[model samples]
Target: MLVAFSLAPSGAPTDSVHDAVAAAVRVVRESGLPNHTDSMFTTIEGDWDEVFAVVKAAADAVGAFGSRVSLVLKADIRPGYSGELTAKLDRLEAAMEQSDDPA
Candidate 1:
């Protein structure tokens, strides 16, 4: 599961990205997911459904920080179970390739 997150302060980026990442980690941990990063976003792989819930929880926590949280969740949505939503650039690539095909 992936949660793309970005933080903006009132006047400037007062809080280092590290701090944001740490808080995000705590949030994810509270929701009970393993393995989080301190970069552009956080990604945790687990029972897809639970991961989705945790993503929301993490977002909520970030919002509580007073920083504008910008995130576009990417995950698969199956009939009842939501799966991991990575990048869909592959689909676009395929479409472009077909368009360029001689046939």
Candidate 2:
């Protein structure tokens, strides 16, 4: 399974939430799960319970930064697949390359 999530804090004193976001990303990274973080979301790959535990911990980390936290989560639950984090992108790039070739 792959979970992509974004966590942030509201009612924070500062306009920038980078620190809070960093806290969340730190939790994800420390989990030692297969993961990637881009500007918009952090994606993690693992079994359901383990992945969600990390997400919950990350949300708790962000909560310390403000009175309220907002979490957006999306999941792709494929029972038999792993390493889709980079594999999916590789497949997309391959398709793009194929399409670029002339008939």
Tens-digit lDDT track for model 2 on 1-103? 9999999899999979999999999999999999999999999999999999999999999999999999999999999999999999999999999999998
TM-score of each: 0.49, 0.97
**Global fold similarity of model 2 (TM-score):** 0.97
Model 2 scores a C-alpha lDDT of 0.96
lDDT tens per residue, model 1, 16-100:
4455546667877677555445546566656656776776666665666555775655543344322333334466788899999
Per-model clash counts, in order, read: 2, 0
Top-lDDT structure, candidate number: 2
Cα lDDT computed for each candidate against the true fold: 0.57, 0.96
Among residues 3 or more apart in sequence or in different chains, the pairs in candidate 1 whose N, CA or C atoms overlap within 3 Å are: 74-85, 75-85
